[model samples]
Target: MKFLVDAQLPVRLARFLESAGYDTIHTKDLPHKNATSDTEINSISIRDNRIVITKDSDFLNSFLTIKEPYKLLLITTGNINNLELEAIFAANLQFLSELFVSHSYIEMTRDSIIVHY
Candidate 1:
């Protein structure tokens, strides 16, 4: 699966996904870097067919209200270090990949993965 990592997330997460053999890009790689607007991010997500992996609730709102960005992986694991976050992804990567095949909105908390219709 392809992914677009948002600014609030560490670029290493994107790198990790890449290392795991998925096509991924971080907001820092964009023209405006982390300053890239959410609208632009959404456009890129739609254009590239990338699932947006973000901690931003705004993305959650957009996904619920308008179904933009094609798909979303919302990170709700609050205030953790990058390594901890990466570990979470590492542990759940396979299930996550499978979930995205049929699910468009998924939320990752410290303890669980919640799939939303």
Candidate 2:
């Protein structure tokens, strides 16, 4: 699976995904890092056929309209740092990947993961 880590996530998560053998891109590492907006990120995901990983609620609106994203993984833990966010994903990689592979939007909280097809 291909993934585009949004600005809210640490670029390191992209490295982790790459290590897991999935294609991944970190927006912070791009040439126009500071210039890229959420819309641009979504557009890139659409063009490259990649799933978007974000903590931003704006994506929820975009997904509602475009619905072209392969999948969306929205982390709802709130204002947490990158390390904590990474830990959450690491702890639930299997379950989360399954949701993505099924091409669904998943809202993950501390105790539960809700999938919307």
Q: Which candidate leads the pack in TM-score?
A: 1
Candidate 1: list runs displaced more than 4 Å: none
lDDT of model 1 at position 16: 96
Least accurate stretch of 10 residues (summed lDDT) in model 1? 61-70
Mind giving the per-residue lDDT tens digits that candidate 2 earns over 11-104?
A: 8889988987789998887667846887778788888888888888888888988884556888788777767766777788777777777656
TM-score of each: 0.98, 0.85
Model 1 alpha-carbon miss at residue 108, Å: 0.3
**Local error of candidate 1 at residue 22 (angstroms):** 0.7
- The clash count for each model shown is 0, 0
Query: Against the hidden true structure, what lDDT does model 2 obtain?
Result: 0.80
